[model samples]
Target: MSDLITVEIPLGERSYNVVIGPEALMTVSPLVAEMMQRGRAIIVTDEIVAQHHLAGVKTLLTAQGLTVETITMPPGETSKSFAGLEGVVSRLLDLNVDRNETIIALGGGVIGDLAGFAAAVTKRGVNFIQIPTTLLSQVDSSVGGKTGINTGHGKNFVGAFHQPRMVVADLGLLTTLPDRELLSGYAEIVKAALIDDARLFDSLEKIGVQVFDSRALSQAIAAAVAFKARIVAEDEQERGRRALLNLGHTFGHAFEAEAPKDVIRHGEAVAAGMALAFEYSVQLGVCPAEDAARVIAHLDDIGLPSEAGKLAHTQWDARRLVARMRDDKKNQDGRITLILARGIGNAYIETNVDEEDLVAFLETKLK
Candidate 1:
């Protein structure tokens, strides 16, 4: 009957459920109602989402007899910065939220990330839920317990590991996502696929998408979550296997932080980073030239940019970008480690990656 699949993120005391498919948004209240401890619920969303799905979220929660408060945020990733996080915290204080109250993050990655962080720090810690509205949030950011605000220092530079009580990822909400945002989210799918499943990459090669449909999205989201959940189960603190999830994020973050963040979205920059990684994989003789071409081809087919202006070629301001790299929690013993692939679905962690070698690779291959 239904084409949706659900995956459970198992973390013992921090365990949670990830609900997928078209009926998800409507099912949100009930799904969360079971997990919540009869506590007050605050739904935090962005203005764009408020215009589209906020009413439905409010109505469903109200129908459940839950005391709900709606806090709408200004749109965009800047909302994931320290200032925006502070604003939400202030509002929660204004509402006088108790320690047991739950914060429902009801929009995209920005809202999920920023609101989750607020819930993490408010009065020390409180319960929170994720209703990731966009493709990026649902399949990637929302499922991960990592929550944070970007600093002038770097992307997701300041953050916490406060997991959500539950995640309701309704593919129906993604129907309204802008084409670019859809492609942006797909980058994570590709990242996850390239690391763990060649079959998933083969599916992307066949689909060649610019926008997402609910049928296809339900599969992609479940696959990403399955791999991420497996990694999280083994290494919740990202001390090991989970590093594979960041296959392209190291380069992606350097570019995200190096460029003017206002212009480049996080997922957009990640697309560029994945492309660069593809090229580096080839240079290392780990991947065939054709495989490298396929990576760029798929990204372009999905309306994701393969190259950016300031961050594209040249040396990537190695000092500035690498400075941020050192700040990554993945850094081990003063060395920056990263995940690189030999080919699609053949990723491996390389702890011995030299800075000059990485920088040189970025300059020539990325160029």
Candidate 2:
């Protein structure tokens, strides 16, 4: 096993450590035992992950004298919904879960969001741990406490700010992920670098997608997690600077809301969104064209969708996409809130954006 890199999210009493490295699943048993000395554990996973790591994890915990129960949901974004939440919560209730027992999320973003949200509402918020399996979940969703399901209005519109008790990001689990899924997660890593760590972005530029198959994977994941931990610690509720973390999310969510089911992955939408953000920033005369070009080039080289038009199996409409953006959770007083960049690693929240200009810019991109 490689050396572990622990990133601390200092949220006072609600604080937790994100243990990142190969074979990090070994840490979950000890952490669970420490958290609930007497209560059994409930692992909320998806059908896909249950087939991969569920048996090993369950056995590992049971061996440590911890009683374990499992709830396996269907895979994909459809699982992140009211129906999904109700199913998980109902099972927890049926199992007579107590406030002391912990909910363990054992899959990717969908499982984490669904399980975390279930923990937040079950018994008025029980403790939960995140054992994210995918690259997207490891670097993005697993670290932050943001939990929720998607709504017809927009993605993540209905969710809670419930932090987990701990996050165990096992790099070894990523080995089982398909290349497309791995690339999807890479978008979030790129977003982190675009938000506030130009140095990390530079490293990615030099390393390219090889980061997924090399020692640099650990460093990239740690850097993204550390960046998010700092942002989350400062603004746990996203009241201020933490909004930077949503650099490409606003645009990304709109793409997601409009795209058909299973048509695009969250990370792919985010990749396109980040590209749109940089291009939009350039259009608004805030970010340099060269910077936007570099971002697009990097995304293209990685085979990620850099524009809505570039996304397969969908015809993007500027007005419809803009309508989805208007419903974004970040918007305030009917004005769209966007994270625009002046250049790489210089993202900022911009709330005074003109809707007409946005529509016009999106129209050009669609063409």
Model 2 segments beyond 4 Å from truth?
none
Q: Rate the local accuracy (lDDT) of all candidates.
A: 0.80, 0.88
Clashes of each: 1, 0
Top lDDT hit = 2
- Span of ten consecutive residues with least summed lDDT in model 1: 307-316
User: For candidate 1, lDDT tens digit of each residue in 92-200?
Assistant: 9999888887889999888998999999999999889999888888889998699999877666878899999889888878778777678778888888888889998
lDDT of 2 by residue, 18-112 (tens): 98887787755676667754557789999999999898888878877788889999998889999999999999999888887778999999999
Displacement of the residue 224 alpha carbon in candidate 1, Å: 1.1
